[model samples]
Target: MTITSQDQKVRGKNSYTFDEFLEKRSSLDWYKNDPILQKALKKYAGAKYEQIHNELQHFSSAVSSRWNPLAERAARPEARPSMLHFDAFNHRIDRVVRPMETHQLEKEVFGAGLFSSKMPAWESFAKRMLIHQLGEAGVACPLTCTIGLIALLEQYPNEDIPELEQILQHTKEGLEGDFAIGAQFMTEIQGGSDLPANVLEAVPDGKYYRLFGNKFFCSVAHADYSVVTAKISGTDKVSTFIVPSWLSGDKDKEKRNGYEINRIKWKMGTAELPTGEFQYNGALAYPVGPAGKGVAIAAGIVLTLSRLEIGIACAGFMLRAAREASLYGNFRTVFGKKVKDYPLSVRTLKKIEDAAHRTTAGAFKIYHQFLFLDQPLNAGIPVDQPIELRKQLFNLRELVLLQKICATNEGAEVLRDAISVFAGHGVMEEFSSLPRIFRDIVVNEQWEGPRNLLLTQIYRDIQRVTDWYPSADFVANVLEGASQETIDRFAEQLTDLLQRPVCGEVSEASMEAAEEWDVFCDSFFKAYQKIALEELQ
Candidate 1:
């Protein structure tokens, strides 16, 4: 049983060194190393390509070398954001206490002036895509919310409300070199996705409104301002408003604007972000648009932007998963051969890579269309617009939903498969980022709208617009570059499904149809993504 020196030498010689994998991973500059993304940037960024590319080079390198580590530190179990309900004086200041790394990460990310007027849309969009690779390291949700807020403000400029203008300036430009963070408080206990059912009251108070009710799910609870949705004081109509977290000069005093954070929700993923339940008691809120048109504005602008960003975020998640997984595969030796050389590993790696490329390509393609159209998303069909423009708008609307559902589903799948390549090392949180990214992707799948909800929404949407844009034509338009046979197959399937009910009173026929519709939608979006990938190639 005594160990021989010869056996010890043999054991040492066979020992595994993961230096190669670590070296390759650490050396990667997310932008410069990604030719696919580079090609995408060049193609879609158009005239702003050079400047944006240059900026991304520095930005992405910093993300890989600097921010990513901060994100890692922030994501640690002990570093999760917490609530401090009272200070030394026992005052009711619901402060969100976070780690130093999170604070630094948030400061630098907001300091980029991403939503500022001086930054081109393409630049901001590209920057966001890069940032999303770090997963929801707290900043991602805030970034998404802030952009939506800026878009809402820009959509409805109210010079009459000086506070509204000042809030916009704080977020869009900086106020004394400090960029404001934004959050959206929409989901109430009574309703989550059902915005119309919300009971939060927005009582008129002079020129401003006072919000009084509880927001059940408020992410980025520590934000400077929030885009709140509430029912008008006496009316049933849901309206959107911008509510500052603290009145002027109150932030330093830790005096919240008539609201208190009940508690921070223990989330399954995006642990670095602070999601809290809030009780609003006469919080001063400024209306964003017409009182009755809040639902439309929220859906058309705010929620739409968030869904679109989810697609982009999923693409970033897949890209990182695909890249790092491939690197690990190539470096690790198994059964006397590299992991990449195994047939199973090869197939798995290819699937992950393909999904990553398809998702990334589809995201860029959709964004390009969005930028080209340069129009606000209108809830329901815009029958007032010219036929072609209306059809294009409809196409964008449906495509956004399609991408959000499909990309998140596949991003989670891809990350799961990528983790498998590392075997036991993958599931260990400290060993890899894949587990955290995978969890974040799962959380994202439910955000904005879950799959079944979105599927039902799309079906209803098509039913509403069928007279103008037929289900068959919709298929053809969405999958523009796909083969005729492929388009016809989907078109026929969709047309048949339209005749049946996919939601409510689940019968055998409806159940069967629902299953078929779910499969058909996923397949159809993959076809569209393939076409996008072809165009990019």
Candidate 2:
């Protein structure tokens, strides 16, 4: 070893910079950079694919370059959303004060009118897929709620209610070029998923209803209107109502519609979005559907759409994780070799990539089928319909639940592994977007339905429909292209599991059956996802 002046200078030099990695990542266009997503879109989009391609490319680039930076900025500790209860006048406003970046991002994203009738369904779907890659940046939750609102209004049209029609127009097509944001406040102090347990009272007014009570877990709390679940003053059945955040002409005066945001929640993720508790005292509420049919309507249409969106969101989360981690793996060097060159890194990256691909394909495939069916989801199994239509609806229903639980579980796993590719830098909030995305994925896992709840639902759904649609035939239909051996194994496993109840007493056999059912659901969904991936190929 020579100790020359040049050698010593070279050894002491500082040349370690992540500039190259950062530049490549920042320069990427999410849609343009992803060949696999392009392939899936081409297969599923069909004739509309070319028409929407350029638009998606542009939107994807905007999401990666423009909106992503805004999301990052909005997610900073100093930029978190807060509640401003009053102004200089000392009057109650209950205003949600968010970062400028969030405001701008929401304005632009909503202005695009993704749910407008003029926008093609595939275009909106693909655009949502792209936007979700940013995670819940104070915009995604509102988009999701607005979607449910639009679906609910469309499902139950009331020609007599001019205000309801106007509300729909404002949300769906925009009013005076200002698109309204929507929220869903279904949770109460007593229940989260137990909708029937809600006790918020809706008293009949002149034409509309007045709500009086509280909503415990309200996300998108700053929205213009919220879809609230409450029971009529005399009725015990839970009903759905759309409550305006501000009465007409009151928004400018900062007058709230008889509801005060008690406090914003401190959540583990989606911190950029405001989740608040509300106390309502005679807030104006417009009923959406039949008085006693709120639970069914909300569960069937509104909640169903949210669950479907969660599956789509999970796909986007996994895609971003895989893409960014793969890039980092190839760029970062350790032990005198690139990270991707290591055997362990290669295997990990492959798993992330594969999961991302399959989840994405599964989402698009499910959406395509949904579009092809061109109908609203029934509250329960459509036993009254023709067997073929019943089977199709049944397939879609089970697929949505299966995709929700499985994709979210896999999405969280993929993101965790993807974070590892960055080594110590992975957990650093400012170092990469992976940590934020990872947290959002975990939240999504428990959002619409948790694993156990959905697992139980799936088992019960099968049991209820076994007489009309046999469990084995259902398996064969869902896992259509799979080998007979593969199909038969799952079918038989499902049949045997259905013999015992998934929710009965805690016996050894029941516990074993529950575990088996859980495992079976995951395995079955993964196989379905693989088939979806194959269809794209």
Candidate 3:
């Protein structure tokens, strides 16, 4: 046989998904395959199990077949939202116009109760996870923000604000076929995590206050209502507010509530979302909590909910990416044999599968505990036993932060590895959803809080306890279902790790401590995850 350049050019080609040729029935039923998910739901959903599971399966199919194409199309630069600074008459409308695809998905999703509180909190979050399997596609941030808004409304209902009832009714209950989407505008050029440094001004204006400042990151800028933080004129303390898109009685009209949509910010991922930097020009704002409690409320409630969603969404992304990769590899051929039969490919797929399993187990385990917290305070425990409350809170805080930082970062890498299995075809957006999912997961890594911030939060939170480090007890308690040997070993390991130096100074000396802190948190969470996965089984 003549060895020629043309002969060398014809080797085994790169493989993508066979999803198009396969019938709908051949598709993976995420609900059925995910026994860990089923097990977790068993701990919380009670009689609603079968119903929720069925609904999730249906939603999964819709995401894969129908909505995904539209959603992906919406991610195109030309398809995203743009501002209409004025109307034909030159009125300052300050409108952010999204594509019809985005509007359609929002309508379908809002009605599905993605952000509505009408359903039990656990079930609502479960549905969100299911939708997230389709990747953020720009919708995840808004949905989580809307859920955060609902949480705030439920926590601090204001009877003085006459419009609160209607906003709640529309957003939480989807009243009369109308649903309101919610957004959070917290980031400023000056203040990243330091809410106290926020300089946005809010002054008394009859019943509502008027806001005057600029927000550097206004995700879901077109949302019907926004949860914003601003300093009252008299003090520098930040307070939370529910700011409407339009004034009262201006429904379905062009009038904005005295704010300007500066421009949609270009982003690397989640292109379906319309994140912008905007300025408030006397925007009407109604305080949600007390003046000085803004930082506590925002951190304790809004950001916490967003971070939790990040954890769940991270797991879902890993599972979907792994499934696609595994499915493709099993049928794909390289050289003379099926790719899955190759030792190296098999090893890679197995590792990806294991990561998916670990993340799913940890996410649902934390989710079960979260559902308990959402119930009446001291749920299932006597009111006098306040220690139990502290234990659960400590465990949940560490779990959520750890999972968000680790899983999102790991999920992106999982997708990267998955794409490698596809060789050249992996980078081609038209060939598979991996490329898009890869970009989205990268964004998820830094969305709510970046890696370093979350690590600092977990370390600081663990260090703050005095009488007893509740996180130590919290970690021990969640690992209860595992073997005593496993539990005892982890207890010793965790205690030893907790004793390490916390990240403080910024010098080369401090940099050494920071690296050590990062490495320890990573190792500790991996161990916790092993126990969690065992418990799930």
lDDT of each: 0.90, 0.91, 0.77
For residues 241-266, what per-residue lDDT tens digits would candidate 2 score against the true structure? 99999999999998999999999998
> Candidate 3, clashing residue pairs?
none
**Model 3 TM-score, 2 decimals:** 0.90
Q: Please give, for residues 132-231, the per-residue lDDT of candidate 1 as tens digits.
A: 9999998999999998898898888898898888888999898999999999989989788999999999899998889899999999999999999999
- Model 3 stretches with alpha carbons more than 4 Å out: 1-29, 32-36, 39-44, 115-122, 375-385, 470-474, 482-499, 507-509
Task: List, in order, the clash count of every candidate structure.
Answer: 0, 0, 0
Backbone clash pairs for candidate 2 read: none
TM-score of each: 0.97, 0.97, 0.90
lDDT of 3 by residue, 45-106 (tens): 77887777777777766766667767777766687678788889988777777788877777
Give me the overall lDDT of model 2. 0.91
Where is model 3 poorest over a 10-residue stretch in terms of lDDT? 375-384
Q: Is candidate 2 or candidate 3 better by lDDT?
A: 2
Off by over 4 Å in 1: 1-15
